[model samples]
Target: MAVPAPSAPAATASFTNAGPAGFWQRAAAWSLDAALVAPFAGWLAWPWIAAPAQAWLDQVRALLQHTGQTMGAAIIDGASLPRLAITLLHDPALHQATAAIRSATWAMVWPALLACALLGAIYHVAGECSPWQASPGKRLLGLHAADRRGRRLGTGRALARYSAGALSWATLNLGHLMATAAPEHLALHDRCSDTRVRAARTGLPRWARAWLVLLAIAGLVASAWLAQAAGTVMQAALERALFWPG
Candidate 1:
């Protein structure tokens, strides 16, 4: 049988024409992506495996503490600040938190890796748009993908745009959260991906229809800041919880 060509994604944008994606739009897109991938990944691997993961991290933290004591001892013996700082790098107590972080992080490796791979596949294969033409989340928001000028981004531009997320996400996903707020509505990833997201002109509710577009933009900035803060909080919490291990 002849292979059927791929079709445009079936869109789920209930509020198309609601205007440009607000922070909520981007947020919804990501939520959709999580919805798409989380069920299988979490159901199959998370709950049952969490205990082992936590236990392993705990042991790693203890080892880090032991190592910290050894380093502290060495520093006292040498009476050297310079050596202490350098040697303290190996300090076990100091690293208990770090090791716990490392261990906890390891636990998420599988799921995060799978999510990233799946996200990439979903994005790259989308329509004739560039790899960055439309993120999987954007498509689900009933948003259309285009460059600022409303042109379809070609292959080369798309790859760069897609690659930008590696950077955008580096700052705790501020890259993505910041995009919806840009006057141009271009995220760091969007510039790299050769794509922009606009509200689809369909079935727009009146309230959303007349809402000031800039409000969405401001919301995006606020939300991105909040999201970044949340990441910092989680990291600190992980450090404290895992501190005893070292």
Candidate 2:
């Protein structure tokens, strides 16, 4: 007996949103990802930041080492106080300086992290559409980042994804490269946010996929060169969200 063929699902009458991101879709997204996300990560992780933290640690250590000398001495303005009071609060000047420096360092650290999160979210959210983000690479390649339902992501969802993304990036210095190959064009962030990057066109020709792959390679080369010239460069979230192989 011949089996009856299953009925095909009817296309939505209204204009429906795009769908899950494909491998090439992600590749297209990567074009801009290189320029934005990569560098921001570098700024905070830069050696300059580490130096300040290290200096502050030394300052604390010195305060502890000198405390024994002034066990319980008190000071009167510029005059020396009892040894006990001095020990109680030795090197107040250095301590204050150290505190100020530490505070400044932290000021940069937390904000830099948040800013990275913000920028990453913006890229994923903004660049899922055509003419996305206006980056040369994205324009040339015709790629964008979209949510699973083929709708553009919202700021709230994007932010949530960004936060999760930070963890993934922290672990791997960017979101997992495994996502694209896993199934959809979504890294950990997109998965958590229920978003994805997908191809705009269906059944794309092999040539287009090849172009995407080449573009991805070129983008990587350029980004690496830029990172080398500077200190470091974090891949742009949009590009990573789109083109990065998962």
RMSD of each: 10.6, 17.2
Off by over 4 Å in 1: 1-20, 40-101, 107-111, 127-140, 154-156, 180-182, 201-246
Q: What lDDT score goes with residue 102 in model 2?
A: 74
Candidate 1, residues 113-228: lDDT per residue as tens digits?
66555556455535426333455655645565566565656656555665666788788878877765746566667766666767664333444333435456768999998767
TM-score of each prediction: 0.49, 0.40
Which numbered prediction scores highest in lDDT against the true structure? 1
Question: Residue by residue across 1-246, what tens digits does model 2's lDDT show?
Answer: 997754322221111444444555454445347556868865755655666667655554444433422222222223355644554555676477567657766854765566565665565545433234222444344444445555445556655655676666776734666465644546766667676554445444566577667777988999998655332212232233334423
| Reference-based lDDT, each prediction | 0.58, 0.52
Residue 2: error of model 1 in Å? 24
Q: Compute the lDDT of residue 104 as modeled in candidate 1.
A: 69
Q: Which 10 residues in a row give candidate 1 its minimum summed lDDT?
A: 8-17
Best by TM-score: 1
